[model samples]
Target: MPWWVEYGRSFFPVILAVFLLRSFLVEPFRIPSGSMIPTLHVGDFILVNKFTYGIRLPVIDKKVIDIGVPQRGDVVVFRYPPEPSTDYIKRVVGVPGDRIGYYDRVLYVNGEPVTERVKAQALREDGQEVLRVPEQLGEHRYQVQWVPQRSSRQGEVVVPPGTYFVLGDNRDNSKDSRYWGFVPDENLVGKAFFIWMSWDSQRFAVDWRRIGSAIP
Candidate 1:
């Protein structure tokens, strides 16, 4: 009956709808670094499907519904283990109970190499030349890049249950699972599936070609 109650009645529904959609449906994220360079570029505005894995409540990140789990080769966004406040995006290389190895610029799972082609060079957003490879991980096919002459991490680790090993598309330049550790199931934010907009900060230009492109 009061003025404040009337104002709340008009706006409460709209605010609640937005909150529910962002928390349970899809969320937007911006690429701030070149970690996933070839697949995702810096300044790219992307969308993450929150319900791809499962329905987790917002803030505390507790899953109340069973839907799905992360799969190999899927590009996912998760909270950084070292700092849960930070969200990181990477490709899932090793799922639960999988053995992973990286040597000679090749990735191996369960002692078998994941198929990839010869390195093809590409220009980075910063104008540096980096080597790229067309690799297939499960059903997802994508390209990964690395700086020539830079040393990358190489080691073998068994992915623990309820955790996954992830790596950036920019191999040598990225400090990912190779540097820290695996991503826990609960830390996952969502699956990155689309790029709605792209802004190349270096050239100060909008990449119209990348706009509306689906992220593979």
Candidate 2:
């Protein structure tokens, strides 16, 4: 047998296993922005359950099976609609056919206000004070940040079928569905579930507290 053929035979199983695992089981991703602050942080390395929403062919992102649907407040990762090559992470604020409203930093779903409590505040390096607001979205609970005096886009939008409305935890700073419109169902990648590592980009140190944390 040729040397190349022998090498292919030896490595084929391992390569195929990895591909299947990543395409349908789990995949690793890194947080490149503060969109999911508090719940997720910049530089946080996360694991997304690829099969949670269904099995999608890798690279093409075409769902081949219907296993599950995205729910309100689920931390989800998807491809940016305008730029399919870019991946983004946000919390699902509105499911298909739901009326979602945002005004004065308060969120409403189907005309009912989603519960939000101001818990605390954190100061950013830029001297901005971000309020720690805990929100209850249906069955899920998570923390979101709001910068007082920071202008944000606010309005109501009815989530269309086969699409979802998502928002960043950093409410005032993120450009999410409010600005870009809905995320098509086909754009969904997976549900973000866990943080495997966290690196403080500014401090150049590991954020031990964020590591191994579960994403809400």
Candidate 3:
């Protein structure tokens, strides 16, 4: 065999294996915005379990296997409904057939207010006061930031089948489903489960504390 042919044969299988594993198993993604701040930070490298919600063909994102659906409070990454080429991450707030509402920064599902309590007070980018609170959804609990002085998008709607309602943990700073609309089931990429690495580009260093941290 020619030298070039031999080299290609040796490396092709390894490359194909990696591609299949990443496409069907777990994939790595980097956080690029503070929409999920406090839960996921900019520059945090996260691992997403692709098979958790079932296997889908890469690029096309068409599911071919039966698996579980996203649960409330699960951090998820999905293709932007308006711009399919772009990916966005947020916490699932409502699954199919659920009535979801957000008014004055408080969430109401099925006419019941989600349980939350003040955790602390902090300042926003515009020097406005914001409250940090822990909100419980299903069996998961996480912190959310709310700016009381700023008006929040408010309304209630029934989540349609094959779609989901999502919101960012940083309620005041995020532009999420409240703005663009529900995420289609087919747009789902995976469930974010952990932060494998973190980098602070502004400081030009690695954030050792965030390394290997589990996603809440």
By TM-score, how accurate is candidate 1?
0.93
- The CA lDDT of each predicted structure is 0.89, 0.88, 0.89
List ranges where model 2 is wrong by over 4 Å.
Answer: 2-4, 115-125
List candidate 3 stretches off by more than 4 Å.
123-128
Candidate 2 residues 1-216, lDDT tens each? Answer: 999999999999999999899889999999999877778888999999989888877676677899999999999989899998899999999999999999888889999878465455566636776688878887788878888878878799999999999999888778999999999999898999999999998999999988888887
Predicted candidate 3: what Cα RMSD to the true structure? 1.9
lDDT for model 1, on a 0 to 1 scale? 0.89
Q: What is the lDDT of candidate 3?
A: 0.89
lDDT of 3 by residue, 96-214 (tens): 99999887677888888784654555666546677777888988888888777777788999999999999999898899989999999989989999999999987899999999889
TM-score of each: 0.93, 0.93, 0.92
Q: Please write out the lDDT profile of model 1 over residues 1-216, one tens digit for every residue.
A: 999999999999999999999999999999999889789998999999999899988877799987899989999999999999999999999999999999978899999877474556566545666778878888898888867777767889999999999999988878899999999999999999999999988789999989998887
Location of the lowest summed lDDT over 10 successive residues in candidate 2: 116-125
| lDDT at 103, model 2 | 89
**Candidate 2 — what's its lDDT?**
0.88
